[model samples]
Target: MAECNDLFLKFNDEIKLGSEKKKSLRKSRNAVGKDIQKYFDETLKVTKPKFWGQGSYMMNTIINPIEGEYDLDSGVYLMHLSDVEEEDWPATSTVHNWIKNAVKNRTSTPPQDKNTCIRVIYKDDYHVDLPIYIKNKDMEHPKLAHKSKGWIDSDPKELTKWFTDEVKEKSDQLKRIVRYFKAWKDFKANGDKFPSGMIFTILTANHYVEGYEENDDSAFVAVAKEIYDTLDENFSLDRPVFPKEELLEGWSETAKNNFLSKLSTLITNGQKALEEENKEEASKIWIKVFGDRLPKYTPPKEENRMDKGYALQTTEPPVLGNYGRSS
Candidate 1:
């Protein structure tokens, strides 16, 4: 019988980011976080700016980073931007520029002003994304700035809470399964055609109910199949935690198709790996799906054989200290 559960436990450990690396990344993130807060405290002169984390890092759904770098999303809320005093407050560009200028030299390279956030790259180590939001006193929702799309309502805290709650309910195995999906996505995507990390999280969370099989491999296989079987071209990922947030709204058809195609292939190969009796054979199938990140199987170290030894057999519990043929 295949000890697939045991093998998967070993594989999970191999892909997990080490405690030392995580500690270092957290330290870097904290330094920049303080800088962002300090900048607003000195200059903004409006309602105080609030800073918090979002995305994978905050949600505790982080997988091993794609390249060598971890991407962190830190959110800063300008609560006064809610007021519609057109003349006094500048557009998002000013806010973005202020943040960019503040963190310019902090990053290894110059900071990038992306569509919705300012990105500070730390080269081979990690990158921090600063997404600025406006929380209006008049309204219940927070609006994110997008150069192209204008202010869009989103609730990062709610989204994070939802994922965190599910992971707790299902145990950390839910997170491991999510990481497995993302790892496969990272290893497999040859170009920019893959779905966003949020989509993967939402989709995985959608199909992830309780009662997972005891084995990690079987649980993952079941989750993958559930997603594959239930997915449709018209599928929309609604943020179950956030009120009316659609995470999958703007996904390109090409990207969706690409994701589905890859998903089907993974399900097929995962099924084969599960059916395999030989671990080496099973690992080969998994390697084809997961690529080089997955650890290859090596037979455990065998005990040294006794010279002229006989294979031990037990019809019943053998009497210890009695090596001669039993009467």
Candidate 2:
């Protein structure tokens, strides 16, 4: 237990201590993987089947880079194992023991999970929570279920290979479209709330837009524009909050105050934007705070014609029929 605690502390220091550097310490995965591999080989006296490979390089995709550091993912996998058929042997528990005892002998601090039957976690400076599970051998393999992310079992190497092959076989036109959307994410994070909302909406609607193929950058961008207009027409605000500031530098007093102020404005504006379906106005407010870089919008000719850009002015003569009207 003490060894485990020590290892956890070391990991926490490396990965979780500072926010700026806290961006997922996937680099540590190399060391961790080697250690796990060595342990597995030594204890089981059986090499991991060559066909299986490790898991994803990234855990979650980042919408805004400057806003925060990202978490990465990396893990081991076993192939040729049938998930459903393996049910005869409490497969989850069996694998969990293999990982726990293997690591325990290698590191003074063996990765330990409260329940070895379910999973064995090696909590380090960065987050390295691995879940264990067998792959269904009978059917076409599916990607790891995000909801069931904590354990191990399905061959990640197989999945990565599949994903890569699928990407290559698909038209480059679609790849370019995906890239455009990726750029849109980067741009929106910079402070273009309008594009961000539109991009998200378009990504979601792409699943349903029949005949509107997303195979090319031009096609994708066109979809983005359509979604933008649709959202603009039906836009409404709901309060939004910025993610917590968990950078490596540690939170500063000024930073905290700034976060609060920014959050308040976003919430107020978001609510107004939602009620009025004023997506443009809501986006303006959204970028004003969360955006890393301020976005520039070209005012319409009528608005730009005025020196102040465009301010609402009272043009009608003052009404006098109402009693108590100011002189």
TM-score of each: 0.84, 0.38
Off by over 4 Å in 1: 44-48, 66-68, 79-89, 243-245, 250-254, 301-327
- Shift of residue 285 alpha carbon in model 2, Å: 6.5
Residue-level lDDT tens digits of model 2 in 1-327: 000112212322322224444343544445455666676577666555222223223311122334333333444354334554533534444666665554454334555454312122334433344544345566443223223233322334443454345345543333333333443354433442323322232233332222323212124424444444443354332211122121123335554345334334433443343233332443354344334233322223332234466755444222222111111
The local distance difference test score of each candidate is 0.73, 0.37
Query: Pairs clashing in candidate 1?
Result: none
Query: What is model 2's C-alpha RMSD?
Result: 17.8
Best TM-score goes to which candidate? 1
Winning model by lDDT? 1
Supply the TM-score for candidate 2.
0.38
Instruction: At residue 102, give the lDDT of candidate 2.
Output: 48
Model 1, range 1-327, lDDT digits (tens) per residue?
A: 243566567767767777886787788777777677676667665555678789988766676755767888888887656675433556778778878877887866999999899988886677888898877666677777775676777778888988888777767887778778888878888775766778778777778755544667767877887787766645576767646776667778787788888888887777777766667787778878877567677666545454567654334222122111101
